[model samples]
Target: MYCLNVLFASQLNHKSILKLIRCCLETQIPILVFESIEYETLADRNHRPSHPCFKPLLFTNRLKIAVEIANAIAYLHFRFAKPILFRIIKPWNILIDKQNIVKLFDFSLSVSIPKGETHIKDVGRGTMGFVAPEYVTTRGCFNEKCDVFCFDVLLFVLLTGQEITDYLRCEKGNKFYLVYDVKKYFVNNRVK
Candidate 1:
């Protein structure tokens, strides 16, 4: 077991973000305590249209949720002194509260953009269908636009509740890999 005399506190007071109550690392696995909210993950809501449990959300509500998430991401990227990157912005990371409010969470893969640096190299630690091609092909060199790329894919998923077309993927060691000519579109803004 590990003990910490100091606690790291985040200064985010946004409505569309989860509030961390406390963090405990006394045991082998660190446990995080968060303020409870009446909500479910976006992934659970974005089920197949043909599924019996599928319940359609109003287009207006969907748009509103998207806007809320976009606003939160924009705030994280631009409002602070140093921009923070939510590297794993996926449906599972977003929660829809009972009041239909969107809350973004899960910052395990996030980082802050160092001053004077336009891009940062990462470990390609994003979802299979939504990762920016440039981030992977360039060996993880990416900027905030990678979040935009992820947001775009999330938008499509929110609208269609399915993976975007034209990208082929196969599972290797339980990890999915895109098999399309991901490099061909890298020249243009098509795959970025």
Candidate 2:
């Protein structure tokens, strides 16, 4: 039910998105599209505004959402003819319709890997905090393990309500030193 973007070539091909859509539909999940421009404008303005829209559902169905996302990812990587690397797997990429069923979306950076290819590219892409350490340092040579790392970060965020980037910064040598120092001060203040 979603319309393809006319200007930008989708990172997710028709076949891949269609397959996932079909799987989701089979499981009784409804996929609907809103005005693309309006959606983008609103999303850009406040990317992480806390809304109570899905809070109750999220807390009540945490396990189900986790399992569904895991299965959907596993299916995309292992069940498909060629593994589709969903380079961005953040919470914002996930959509839940009125039925509370999980449908993965926003495959803007997805890549299809051939059977023998070890890594997709020498340069890393995707959200900074979700990126794998090796990919960031070595500038390449990442696999499903990279996705696993991102997934772990997402899981941490979902469970703790604390941003992974916040934790990553406090570990030292991260770019956001001032933000991390402020966070550390608050944390230490609370402990004492």
Candidate 3:
């Protein structure tokens, strides 16, 4: 793991972009330091659709972002010595470079599954709408599947250009969630 970390750091250093380090402190926390560069957060970009600097994401661009996020999660869960579950997957945690490359940042909510353990149990933690149902119902018993579920929700937002908690304003000022609306539409065969 140490060697792989060094190799990744050196390769990223060559490009002067990212630097990964594994510090053997008392807590054994791994620190990732990214080079300072002008970049836009995915949340900001998506939410500021009418901003002067906001450039609309093309369909292909959105797909590219999704693929990049999936690859990052795959690396964390498969390539590392200890598989990591990214408990929080949201637009706010994603950044887009000038080249439109998606960078998945923020590891604060990530947890590494103990060796020989398939899942971990803890208090459920994550943004509300992006959290997996099982994780919530099971009181935070989760595996990589939780991450996949959150990724699917993020994909829904990416494809539909709708926030997970999107609300429909009615005559009485009542609100309904976008997810519920989608579910209702599918259930009633109105989506077709």
Which candidate's lDDT is highest? Answer: 1
> Where does candidate 2 stray beyond 4 Å?
1-54, 57-60, 169-192
lDDT of 1 by residue, 1-192 (tens): 022211212556688888777776777777887788878787766654455654556677778889999998898898777777787778889988656788898777777777999887877477777788788888988788989888877876676555443333333444434324334345555632
List residue ranges in candidate 1 displaced over 4 A: 1-9, 48-54, 164-192
Between candidates 1 and 3, name the one with more favorable TM-score.
1
Best by TM-score: 1
Q: In candidate 3, list every pair of residues with a backbone clash.
A: none
Better of 1 and 2 by TM-score: 1
Off by over 4 Å in 3: 1-32, 167-192
Sliding window of 10 residues with minimal summed lDDT for model 2 = 37-46
TM-score of 2: 0.61
**Cα TM-score per model:** 0.76, 0.61, 0.74
Candidate 2 lDDT by residue in tens digits, 1-192: 222221112333332132232212233543534322212111211234356433334454545656777776776678666676776777777665444455566655766676778667747477877787777767776677788777766655554456556666765676632334446656887422
- Report lDDT per candidate: 0.71, 0.55, 0.69
Clashing pairs in 1: none
Q: Is candidate 2 or candidate 3 better by lDDT?
A: 3
Q: Tell me how many residue pairs clash in candidate 2.
A: 0
